[model samples]
Target: MAGGRIADQVGRVLGGRYRLVAPIGTGGSAHVYVADDTTLRRRVAVKVLQPALALDQAFLKRFRAESQAAAALNHPNIMRVFDWGEDAEGPFLVMEFLEGGSLRDMLDSGRRLTVSQAVLVGLEAARALDYAHRRGLVHRDIKPANICFDDEGRSAIADFGLARALAEAAWTEPDGVLLGTARYAAPEAAQGRNVDGKADVYALGWVLLEAVTGDAPPVADTTVATLMARANQPIVAPFGV
Candidate 1:
């Protein structure tokens, strides 16, 4: 009920320009709305940070930092951030509204791409990551869920440079949290050690492995076990890769 109330900003206007039209998606710390850009007269996505995380001083810092990092990048294969703002409800970010669903959705529906097919998707994703790495930013989260497409079947990396900030906000949850999903987490990230672009590279590698094999990596019941596996086990190469 609480989350629903906050997310019910269906008709609210943000930045005096974007009007929230409907709830499109939700994440641990944010609610995504398909909104109308009144000024541009176009559709856009507005991701509002849940009230609690928005109110937390530490999380807000990371939030702004991540927003800034993502907004600074321009790549064909990265989700494009347009603007950000705060209101009585909390902080929100604006981004391009994509039409095609996530890669994860396709895989769950038994639509695994062939190795050659996945290579094209992988190349686009890799290009986005490389662009961020060159700019001193890291995606921190690289999974099929974060890989989205457009109406044209083009793939792009979502939350390209904000994983750190979002992960940091999630850390303040009642129980602590890991920065990214364990199934695709990099070894250093699973260990809570300092990480860099290489972490994203590692996670991307795992994602591609799953893409080719049509096998979802084992996600342990406990975060601890997941961490142990990523940190201790050497990943098997994808079949036929």
Candidate 2:
């Protein structure tokens, strides 16, 4: 769904600064818009939290704290978060605009990266994760959709602390709803154990494998089943990797 255009939000302005130009993407938690940062005189991507999440005071508080931490991260492979705040509409984050799309977008379009390309992307992502990990920040969510590319095809990790913030929230959901993507989840994450930087490494391995093979790690029908299927099992690489 290109842009997933929302007419009402298309012309709306947030925080009396960002003018929503067009919807760029929609995810399970929020809808992203390409907006004009009037103060900065530049384009930016604004991610507005879902209304249901906005209503949860606890979630909003955790989210605010996480966004603040993420905003302080500075690295070439990490997407830059400029500002975050709540307005009449809801909570929103201002981020650097990436024009090269995402790894998820490339895969969805039926394109598989060559081995060399996958390795390069993986290296950049690993560097970003390492930088964050050393500073006591673990990215609880690492998936194709969270890896965005810039105009020059440089990959950067996005949505740094969103999953952890969400997990801390008191928002209610259907029993089967999972906080992050099951297919890319690490074993410790799936088993409800404490996760460190290794979880991010595991997920990135899966992402790199998918990049070269054009397939997600095997998963079952249900969220529980999917997580259990890969929990303790080792991921087998295809021949010639």
Candidate 3:
């Protein structure tokens, strides 16, 4: 089935619980939707595994296992996973709904945030990464789009779909499919190698650089070969007022 049609079908209720409201965003492996949890009587975010991924037994197993691992991590700065289960359609994860929107939106708005505001965002993200790192999880995807801000201005790291426990196999080889955003992916991740907390730190640095300068740092390539080549290169100073 075509992806769009599959997405449309999944838009209907699954397991008689979550009612998909609308698609919030799409990542490399899944589509996130704003959903209403009938059982709990509140809104939540539902991430539906992509049709291609859902059909792959190996990938589906890893997806569910990794998501379960991520669920064990609970922090104020991390989005909470309420549940995970499979339906006739596919696998899905129910997560806390955040209203404000993604950091990517803020950056694209062309609003120049004060250094203090930017720093606060960075701090919250750093804290979240620290917590995850301590728990032995590495958030392979930490770009602005995955960092969400609530109405109260609190930053929460939203997507752990690409996150992997430190002990797990880092990537699905033979495909050479990189799992994260090109611009913000760490050198190790870009190279399709195992990554640790330092990768998250590098991605966070890119986010901070973007927030301060209103532009993402240039990348030589989305691959690890290119990333490793320029990983240690110094960043340019922020634009002066």
Candidate 4:
């Protein structure tokens, strides 16, 4: 479920502007909804932070700061952050609505992309990552779920979240704790070492591999196992890929 009643949040208005229309998706950190931006007279996606994260003052502060920075990012392959605000429930971000779903969705359907298709998607995402990196922002989390497509079949990166902010804030997670998906994390990220844009590149490589293979780069069942599996390994693209 999204977050208890949070998933049932429909017809609710936030900041007296965004009217939640329907729950679109859910992730560990937030629930995303398709909302109507009354002021802008357009449909937009609203990502509401989980109630637990919302209650943490430290996270809220960093989240807001990061959101502002992410919003400033301008690239065709980057999801545009139109606005952000807080309400009684939690802090929310208003963003461009992409109807093509995510790479995760496609791979989950058991259909793998062709080599050409995968490369195109990877190229677009790489461009977006490079742009963000040049601006001194590291995504920290780069995986299929964050690689979304628009109605036009163009891939764009989404959800530049607290993982990046927390890293920059120098806030440490307890040992063995992880921020993003372990399957896509770089060795440095998995080991809780300092990371840069290269980490994003590493993760994107995994995403592209998964895209063409229709399988995650072999990891074990447990989170720790997954982390250990890749922590000291080299990335090997499958033959002919």
Candidate 5:
């Protein structure tokens, strides 16, 4: 995904204030950078859309979804978005920088959290979701990759990119659309139906299950018919918590 010097964009300055320091991570459509906000004199995470994604009208719409939803939220467990604007590279969303890395890292290390630790993480993340849900937002994506930690190892939910509001719920585009990560998605979501707070709660159950089991959920090939059919199916858990 990184081109020659494009990979070396660490020293570049964006929007005349944010200076890129290093690459932090990447998503389906953006590369995240830890940048110094020269104007504010603090470090921030910058999520810049890839050139290919920036050029797609559809991706731009989804990008705007996260920016708008996150900008409206002000909860402690939810990642805070400070500012967003386009630079020469592409459109970027500026957010607070958290150093504790992601929950995916924790899970991948093969070290399971104690029962109490896992409970605490689940509580904090659930609070974040409850806060947003009360305000009519459904965070469609809730896999490990989107759950990060704070300096004290507290769980925080990031990347509300697939979040959809209840009133104007647009579950699908003109063509068929499955808005979230298939493995964690609620059945209604895969069927392109309006999902409520229940969908997020369901996803959290999967997150916690993986935390204790060290197993990734299996994903069947996602097709319109199959995805919708999953709605009528019952999921059998491998083990009891």
Candidate 6:
């Protein structure tokens, strides 16, 4: 089989249980598949690490460690991790499958959400952040692509792939790669500084502003410069959609 075909097949019987149905999305570190858990007879979102990322020992270790920590946290607004382990192929994560598409996609449809709707989404995400912060976990990456909704329209934060557990006291700085979306990133993260839960709050505010205004806040060309700028400015009110 070709590489893609083999990946399709390996995805078929991940961990000798979950049967991959189709690829739902792909990120820098992993690919998410809609899968059926044969043993439990239920659906799940399966995240398989990219081969390139799997080859990086540091990334694999951080991936497993952060996922394990996230799995320990249970909340209504956070995507729940059901399992995390390495198969012969590579590392993978089994999580609750949320049916609704991402916030980025919704916004791209050109439908401006009402202020209440935006607040509801932001509030739910805020609660999730509060929960994670209490547990000393910082979701280093918070962007529209990482925020998802379910069938009933409840918001859940996704993509903990960049998550770091503060309790562990092991920090890995982001290198050349941008750790988060430029427009929504907190100034601290943009500046390559070590961040905590407040960074998430800043990012959430930016997301809420965009949700209501349909426009992203202006950002400086450089990440450090951007954080400095954000520190000085007051929150801008959302423009009428």
**Candidate 4 per-residue lDDT over residues 14-60, each given as its tens digit:** 99999999988876656899999999899999988655555667777
TM-score of each: 0.89, 0.92, 0.82, 0.89, 0.84, 0.81
Candidate 5 residue-wise lDDT, 128-190, digit = tens: 999988887668778787888879886778876543421133223312223335667788876
Better of 2 and 4 by lDDT: 2
Error of 1 at 137 (Å): 0.5
Residue 148 accuracy (lDDT) in model 1: 87
Better of 4 and 6 by TM-score: 4
**Runs off by more than 4 Å, candidate 5:** 3-6, 57-66, 161-180, 221-229
Candidate 2: misplaced stretches above 4 Å? 1-5, 172-180, 232-235, 239-241
Computed on alpha carbons, the lDDT of every model, listed in order, comes to 0.79, 0.85, 0.73, 0.81, 0.74, 0.74
Between candidates 1 and 5, name the one with more favorable lDDT.
1
Tens-place lDDT digits, model 6, residues 1-241: 1347544653468888899888787654557788999999999998776444545667667777888788888899999999876765557889999999788878889876798898889889999999989888888778888899899999999866444422132333332223335567665665668889998898888787777777876766665555566666654666543
| Count of clashing residue pairs in every prediction | 0, 0, 2, 0, 0, 1
lDDT of 6: 0.74
lDDT (10s digit) by residue, model 3, range 1-241: 3457545864588668999988887654557889999998999988776444455666667767777877888899998888887765557789889998888888888865578988888888889989988888878877888888778988899767544522243333221234236567765665668788998899898888787778776656444544665455555645772
Between candidates 2 and 3, the one scoring higher on TM-score is: 2
Model 1, 31-137: lDDT tens digits are 78889999989999888876776567777788787888898898989989998888777788899888887888888788888888788988898888888899988
Cα lDDT for residue 107, model 3? 81
Model 1 residue 216 distance off true place after TM-score fit, in angstroms: 1.6
Once superposed on the true structure, which residue ranges of model 6 sit more than 4 Å away at CA?
1-11, 87-89, 165-180, 219-241
Regions of model 3 farther than 4 Å from truth? 1-11, 165-180, 220-241
Worst 10 residues of 1 by lDDT: 171-180
Candidate 5 residue pairs in clash (backbone atoms < 3 Å): none
**lDDT of each residue in 1-241, candidate 2, tens digit only:** 1243364688888988999998888776678999999998999999987667778888888888889999999999999999998866668899989999999899999998999999899999999999999999999889899999999999999999888877876664343445338888888888999999999999999899989898777767777887887787776776666
